[model samples]
Target: MAAPTPVRRGAARHSELFDALVELLLTEGFAHLTLDDVAARLRCSKRTLYTLAGSKEQLVRAAVVRFFARATERVEAAVAACATPADRVAAYLRAVAAELAPASARFVDDMAAFPPAAEVYARNTAAAARRVGELIGEGVAAGDFRDVPVSFAAEMVTATMVAIQQRRIAGATGLADAEAYEALATLLLHGLARDPATPARPSAGCRS
Candidate 1:
């Protein structure tokens, strides 16, 4: 076997650094930490950290982007394994909750305070809303859900997600972010369920 090339080695090191950076930010946040602090915590030199990004703000933003990119991949994988539209919807939201389970409140607050990181989070939230809309549409087409306005339902879900991210739901309901996501999934599934009295139509391609 050929030895690993320098480029491959550098890429592996960068991936390791990114994973460490994301773990640090998710648990402890970035607003209170300087670049020096990050280097110290990661047990690396400032020069090495610069290889990832030019500044602390940019580094945090990159980490945020990496975190969401990984989370989306896992969430989609979970959704794809489900056999029915309802199962897909539930798996998507629950997978999101599992992915976010590691994010501390401090990290969430820091993201809200940092404009660049916050923007990344906002974009991901919007994407998640669009995904939910697609799942809901599938459920409706399959007769598993009511034929409600897809856009309206998606918008409502988006509002709830924003509230959860901003901690409004936490403040009002005392639910953690992960718990809130689980609740949202349950509520959405229940809300979209077909009425018991309604006759069941043979769903095309839906598995029991």
Candidate 2:
């Protein structure tokens, strides 16, 4: 496989300002956060803020990057802990289902409500897709997933989850329980379950 590309960094790369902006954005929404407010939160000057990350948009993008970076760490750690490939994939999705934060949901809504924000979100989401695809490839290597196109299957799972997240952001989180078992069950029915032994566990249905 070819090497994945990397993203470039911009001015105003101070980690402190980056974090403050993310927190403010999370609590106040990007629409309400201002550079001045961010400076105040960080006990810094407007000069310091501008010297580092530039406009609110840049700061916001940095925040998104930081958020996903941290999330990658957590999800990777979760995926690594499972005993088998099937279990790892299950653990990975479950971790994603469980990782939704109100701030993340709010960010999704705010971005969809505004065009430029939507573009930033699109870039971030594309990066996220590659990460998810890598996880699926790992599962395939372990013989826990069907021998199919990893990127496409990964995309299917990623797109479905994005739809779920968007619905959650829109206050239309359709399920009664956030456990996401219904989707999990659906995946199993569609033969996403890689471990043949998995269905045999009391949850068995349609096992021949």
Candidate 3:
């Protein structure tokens, strides 16, 4: 068998380190985390950690990005596995909840408090909206959903999720992010459902 390429080997190493960092980040917020602290926990040298990122902030950002990227991949796969568009949307939201279940309150708070991490989260949420919009478009094409403007509906969902994440809605309504996402999926799916008694609306192409 051929030896693994340097890039592949590096990715494997980084994956291990990222896993450890994620666990620690869940328990401790990014604001109080340091390279040395992570190095000590992972039993790796500071130099080893520096190989992945130039600084602590960069490291945290990289970890957050990598973690969410992996989670999104999982969600997309689950969504694709569903036969119907409604099932796909539900699968995506459920996959997201499963991915986020391990995150503690401290981790969520840290993502909001840290600017770099917050930016990573913002990008992830935007990507999710685009994906959801595509799913809605597919549903319309399949005659499984109402002829709602996909872009408008997707933006609404994204905006609502952001509000929940930032604690704006959560603070006012006492709803957790997970609960908000569940409610979002329920509301969106219900609103888009094609009535058996009524005729389907005309298709409006809704691309992300």
Candidate 4:
């Protein structure tokens, strides 16, 4: 049999690299990140680093995206595990808070110092808002939520989350990720709740 083609040596998923990236981002902050630090932390060669992730910028962006995705997945699972709509919403917030550990807190601070990464982050935030708007709409249809402007509501929640992140870094008047999620959910739900005094409104113009 012909020998199998040589496996090209390049970056694998490299969980270690991602973990290291996150750890350093927290300890050193973003602007101060250097490949040498990651290599030192991982005790890997600089050559291995290059093969694993291209540049500091690439690594930071990838690590942030991957971290958030993993966090979201776990939070989604938490939300699914709840039996009541109220429970599910509360659990979702907690899950989100738990995901924003101290390390993740530092990533945003660092991202702000770099314009290119910052722009990527801003775009990502908008995408996240659109995706979450869909979930809020689902709640409304189930009668668990009142009709609210879906897009606007989602943007408000996302903006609030950003503020929470900033607060976490500031170490003053901090809201744990879970706490922020719960408070926001409650605030939104209470405002949008249907009642004798408040008729059910339709989010007719809201986008899918």
Candidate 5:
């Protein structure tokens, strides 16, 4: 077989670099890091970093977008593997929590402070809420959920998600963001369960 083309190799390298950058930001936060710092952390030259983004702010924004894009893909995969609507919903939230497990408190705080990154997070949150609504509607139609208003239930979940992202839930309940997501999944699934005594079926990759 022929070796990969130059363009393909470059694209692959860019992807690897971006993954490293996102991991770094998620672990350490971006607010205190300069371009030099980032370059040093990634073990790449500043020129290579510029190839990904023209400026530090842009790089951070791009990383945030990439993070959520990857996360959404994984979350959807989890939901798709589920056979029941209730399990899909539970899987969605559980996947979200798993995706967010790597993010540190500092990273969350920095993302909130950076408007571009924050906007990306906000958009993802809204999209998640809509996805939850759709899942709830499906459950209701399947007679798996109670006759609750889908819109209201979705909005409540959205509000809780926002609070989780903002650290309000942590402040109020002492639950970390990921922990809050787990609790949300449990609460939502139990509340929506047609038989309160029966537990929602766990989906692939989803914990109890």
Candidate 6:
């Protein structure tokens, strides 16, 4: 991907501010957080914050989009490091879990409260679902998984992801998002498991 537009004068300071803002969002959630709160936390003025974006909502939106962009990079890297399709699938989910592990219940609720942030998160979810579909296709082609219909399986996993994000299953089962993702990896792969007696081949369509 191309580089993102510069947000501030110094790259280092910009990164620091983004990280601090993310921490605040994760701790306090977006609903109750204010421009003043961000300024106070960063030891800066509201004017200084404004230099980054036009308004409070815009600032948060930019930060959230940046955060998810970085997360996607990390997840892609993690998946690429694996040798097999099964491993790639596991790596992808595990990387996602790690990225989301810091998010608390309040943080997720806050994202729902903010439309811009919610939209960014929803886009991330859609991308993840597509990636999962690709991995499943690779596994099946490599004889590592069953011959499940790619579209149907992908939608099923995507629907489950949406449920997980909405906290529907998590609220009822008391599972954190990260835990839910791990469980999903296990459940999907186990259900599609191929016999160990057969030799597995690398998928030509999948690169790691």
Query: In terms of TM-score, how similar is model 3 to the real structure?
Result: 0.85
Score each candidate by Cα lDDT.
0.90, 0.60, 0.81, 0.63, 0.91, 0.83
> Candidate 3 residues 93-201, lDDT tens each?
7677777777777788889988889888888877877788888889887778887888888888888867866767767787666676777888888888888788755
Q: What is the lDDT of residue 168 in candidate 6?
A: 85
RMSD of each: 2.6, 8.9, 4.7, 6.5, 2.7, 4.6
Candidate 3 regions with alpha-carbon error over 4 angstroms: 1-11, 196-208
> Candidate 1 regions off by >4 Å?
198-208
By lDDT: ranked, best first: 5, 1, 6, 3, 4, 2
Residue ranges of candidate 6 with Cα displaced over 4 Å: 1-9, 196-208
- Give the per-residue lDDT of model 5 (tens digit) for 106-173: 99989999999999998998898889989999988877788899889989999999888777898899
Q: What is the lDDT of residue 89 in candidate 3?
A: 85
Candidate 6 on 1-208: residue-level lDDT in tens? Answer: 8665564336667677887887777777777778998899889888878877889899889888877898899999988878888888888888899988888888887787788988889889989999999999987887778778878889999999898877787888999888999899889878777766766565443354
Inter-residue clash pairs, candidate 2: 11-52, 12-52, 12-53
- Candidate 1 residue 64 Cα shift, in angstroms, is 0.4
Candidate with more favorable, higher TM-score: 1 or 2: 1
Model 2, global lDDT: 0.60
Cα deviation at 116, candidate 5, in Å, is 0.7
Looking at model 3, residue 25 earns an lDDT score of: 83
lDDT of model 2, residue 116: 62
Better of 3 and 4 by TM-score: 3
Residue 56 of model 2: what lDDT?
75
| CA displacement after TM-score superposition, residue 8 of candidate 6 (Å) | 8.3
